[model samples]
Target chain A: MEDSLVLVDIGNTNIHIWEEGKIYDIKNPIAFGEDVFYISVNENKEKEFLKLNPSALNLKNVVNFDTSYIGLGIDRIMACKAVDDGLVVDAGSAVTIDIMQNKVHLGGVIMPGISSIKKAYATISPKLDIEFGELNLKKLPQNTQEAVTFGGIGAVVLMINSLKKDKKVYLTGGDGKFLSRYIDGVYVKDLVFRGMLKTIKEDLREGKK
Target chain B: MEDSLVLVDIGNTNIHIWEEGKIYDIKNPIAFGEDVFYISVNENKEKEFLKLNPSALNLKNVVNFDTSYIGLGIDRIMACKAVDDGLVVDAGSAVTIDIMQNKVHLGGVIMPGISSIKKAYATISPKLDIEFGELNLKKLPQNTQEAVTFGGIGAVVLMINSLKKDKKVYLTGGDGKFLSRYIDGVYVKDLVFRGMLKTIKEDLREGKK
Candidate 1:
């Protein structure tokens, strides 16, 4: 399966190019460029990608869906299309857990991202501007940060436990490894980008069906 | 019918003492002069109130509850007990709307406080600070603050309209006047505190049955 195709993953904060089995980080350009097919799950990014890559005049070959699958984010749609009966948890700007049974979309919950949750207490309450530390699974958190970390991780672990009844849970993104320590499930980082490539392959194979 | 009795209204942030049709602002104190039966909703305040007025320890007349009842706040309970059938909208720290059908309690919705909603955007995104302004009823909101204000008001209007099938809607709290302009329901700003006073009269007659 030797295919010479360039897949551009436009995400919430960053963009990546998928060539062969390697992912190359690319700067999100200010204008649309030729020889680039843009796929993004974020509406804002999709608009920006189109504005920058005016060459993306028609999305006839491009698809947009958020990770939630209610719409596509390059990361989410890719994650959904990439797995088979596996759970993909994107612990990025927002912590989203997407589960696919036989590669069909099953909804998941959206919670405050790790940093977002940490910033919540700090920004909302002046007394809670402390740095959050790693969660100790064996003991209950004593302070506010520890409590937040414990609760945040507990939420993800609970979600995984709920889905683990019949599937394997895969982790990805910045907070995935941190979460993996508390989660009792299989995890694979860097799957968000891979899922994007896989979605492109699927679209190509099915002839844009 | 003229009884020389003083009524006290305890709230989350302030206290109001009603005497001779006039309301006086009173800070919850650890000690108060004679003829004052100190009462408060805050556990800490209640302890101070008892210490300030020794009679409050043996009075068995102070009333309070936490955020668990159908209408927990003194204002909410007072408002609910005031009207026979109507919708009660409390626009305080949080905006909550509940329905009373012939004095029966129906469920309500709890949403972000009006001020909090506008503050949320700024808190989450440091660059998007906005100050609320006077609302124009005839036109749609164009800016962020206006949008949030409209949203906050719209949510209450929607709920009131949805629940006003067979009941009159009543508005209370400091923001009641502001909200009343955006809604078609009746506004009674002091309904909660009034209702609490009425309850006290009834309980005194019934001997705390």
Candidate 2:
């Protein structure tokens, strides 16, 4: 097994395996060298993927950062790698607001993403059915479609504001720019991937020893 | 038919009729006078109820307040009656943030109430299963259950802040008090009912003439 490490992040909708210089979905996975490891929310998927290569490692003993937060997701820890102290606001399929002060995880807020909020309304009150493109995402929303859109924006801004009191907010994920449109924060793409790199470094150092 | 008018506001979940000095749900509709008027989101329910009393009056032109807003909900109009300007935030099964500047409805934001937020996540992503009690609602939520609970709280507070720039905010609906816990706004229990009364007085003045 080579000193290189592989990181697989399993979420609700998709599985992401980081290899080489990019992140890939399961269908588009790029084969990496030996010393592969994975962290996931889906225990079943993790087990299934591990079946293919019994030598693959599971990430253990996280790293220098261990917070009091219970159920600390690896993705959050990845974002934590960016800055020791500051808040990480991930705006993707789900909006996660994590507060990390001096490398100690103080827990955070997790809520539905904008799409999740829109989907929730459509499912419950069918009358609330309306759609707006990304361009219309900004502006004073006039109708139900726009209102829901703007409300989705407002929902994210508020949650971040609630947790981000005087803390420098580090934003990541798909809708990070959309959120940054209002909130003052540093938008860092590929936060989870950064987290993967953080672990790979640890593994690399361990290899040398 | 008596000249004293009845106001019925039929919504997706329930129907409310304003008679005397009180607002009653469909379940406990007081024995109203023959003269009746209704505003509803449900056209089918409107037709069904209209069949019972042909002599009753269905409010046509809404009332004095006519903002240039498209798709203005009766519940919104009801809240509008309370304030000629500022913002009307109804924190019911859904959270609606309507901005009225100089008594003209500019537009608004509609989002999931606490229940809707919870329901949306529950329906779409079953893995997002978290529950928090009312007491847990007031605290800075620690767990996923609490994060979700606080997320719901933050969602409402943010939307309200988006439109309520330096303007007084009027809050109503079931979760008004819950929201007022964080947001500095007046929690009117029956804003829609107050709106009903505002129109009833107009009808009374027109009747004398």
Candidate 3:
């Protein structure tokens, strides 16, 4: 068994795993030698990963960061490391834009996520009552549902445009993939996990520094 | 039906009513009379009121002010007329403090409302989940729930203290009643509706200036 390293990418909706440079779904725990990369929101799943092998405990490397911090989101940090200098957009539970220049983060904006946008519209204006997914790019939505989707996506896209300045753009998160196709930018599905791994490795090395 | 008048008071949470010189629940239609006073959001509820008396639909007066071009909630206009040179604290879903000196609003703050305060804690620190009612005046709460409530109220109280300057304070809204007791001010629940009625009467008599 090699030195077990657990890489956990805790997100609003899901936790991702990257062990030996491979993504593993924690729902089904597997024996990945001494190096076990794991991430989860559900306590039972995390415990399951830990119990994959009793001997795997001693060499376990765990990294945890709370997502509630104002300037820090796991995904944001991950995007920073993934791109040297670019606009990183995470359209997850909320739409956030993190700007980085020369590997240094330049603060970002926190707007209503895709769902929250629809939720707010429906909530604030009862006349606009509709669901979130109903939003899609239409020249002009004939119905309220289509109109709402267009409205919500339009607002977010406009916001993203406001944040974008001559730089490579990267999109991540569940909503990110869906929004990426419509956006003029690069898309990285595993950006958060990859960023976490990079940050962990940096912290570990900086400990020596 | 002696020249029936509709009064509308739109606040953060629910719109209020002042019909025929009496306060009524904005949701209830019976509280209305002839001559429509469609003011702010309550215009949505007025349709129900119209059903009761067919004669009430004689004049539909929609109070339309450019909210975008001008930074004012309809409640502020009412507050301005109801109380001369007073500090109006509309504490509903969110706490807003507007000061009017000589019948003119001097701008205000859009700090997190009590609910938003509770929400911010949950959003920024979801682990400390708690409700507003549970909050107490404590320096340090022994538990997470108390801590959340304490922090939320403390923040509002602190903000009010900073913004307050010896001026007549008037509190409105349902939640405003709860907060009024804690703050150094007077409570005028019917101010919004009363103000709207006053505005309509003035506009009707004077003709839109």
Candidate 4:
């Protein structure tokens, strides 16, 4: 792998760039003079970035994985690829939970992310427009803010915990650290980038053959 | 408790009216000639309904419950009032889950209801604009639609069940019957009205005293 190789993960909201062991989240697509590899969920942003850096390779085209799930997002596939035997949770605009056992994908489920859940409540009623704060999961809420906050965060925590069982759980994405506080899981900020790098290295080895 | 007494539950989306054991969900507020008693979460709708029927009574003004929860929705309180001992799952635009033991309110959490959850997913991205269908909770989903449906519904089901423990669960609101299928709970469609009637009767007895 070239030292200047850049790994980009373009999502619905932001463009995440990984370069030289550093990560940066930019609002809009930016040009890169260096060799770039990307997996994008946003078609428009991908196209915009492609126009600027025409030589950039989309990792989705080169990377292959063993998964039966159809229409699964490439970002999710990449995250799962990084894990050999664990549950991978990609918590961004959407929280996706996928499991991998002995190098085989065992499907997954998707839930709204924390901010999206908060926005959903706000859309339902103006009175419910409040930020989620520190809460005690053992004690039930006694106010609207506590109720909304607990419900929004608690459900996600409980669902993940229930599905976790005895498996090793891997957490990634923007809200990964926030969820790590509640869930007993390893928070890997660069899991997706690691997956992308691994796939690129494997592809290079195949080219030599 | 008069046969002519009309009980109305004004929510964010619709106004549910119960009269003579029949219930009606109307988009616009309607005037009733007979004595009307109501509990409303929507302030504007309540004001509009009051103009249509000048003598209409707001049940929130009269009905009282023993609860430490501040800013608790009156509709949720009414549902809790109907059940002496149980976890009340009021599944509407916002699914409010409250606990009542020996006629005492024990606080609860709020999560997005079925439709709101669906809309939340849709709002996150256009690709997730599919409708939720029947899903098997035991199995992880292998498709986008199934994954979303499972996550959206499964989280709520698990949260309610976890809180329920050995307590009886009472479901009400629009999606009460739908949730009843997954949860081992009794579905009472007019739980709010039952509560309203109960409070009205109690208030009348207190007035005579």
Judged by TM-score, which candidate is best? 4
| Number of clashing pairs per prediction, in order | 18, 0, 4, 0
lDDT of 3 by residue, A46-126 (tens): 566567644542111333322222435444656666676888887766566766777766555554466554454544445
- Lowest lDDT sum, 10 consecutive residues, model 4 chain A, at A200-209
Name the candidate that leads on lDDT. 4
Clashing pairs in 4: none
Using alpha carbons, what is the TM-score of model 2?
Answer: 0.85
Residue pairs in clash, model 3: A94-A113, A135-A149, B94-B113, B95-B113
Better of 1 and 2 by TM-score: 2
Tens-digit lDDT string for candidate 3 (B16-102) = 665677775543555444465544445545455456644542212534222121335555555555766767777765455665676
The C-alpha stretches of model 3 lying farther than 4 A from their native spots are: A1-12, A19-31, A38-48, A53-71, A120-127, A131-147, A197-209, B1-27, B31-48, B58-209
Report how far residue A74 has shifted in candidate 3, in Å: 3.8
Rank all candidate structures by their DockQ, best first, as comma-separated numbers.
4, 2, 3, 1
DockQ winner = 4
What's the lDDT for all of these models? 0.56, 0.70, 0.55, 0.89
Per-residue lDDT tens digits for candidate 1, residues B21-63, read 6766767654444445333555666666566566532112433
Cα distance off (Å), candidate 4, residue A202: 2.9
| Better-scoring candidate (DockQ), 2 or 4 | 4
Question: What does candidate 4's lDDT look like per residue over B1-209, in tens digits?
Answer: 38798988888889998988999899988889777888898889989998998898777777768899988888988999899999999998899999999989999899988999999999888888898888678998999999998889988998898899889999998899999999999999999999998888876447532
Lowest lDDT sum, 10 consecutive residues, model 3 chain A, at A58-67
In model 4, what is the error at residue B76, expressed in angstroms? Answer: 1.1
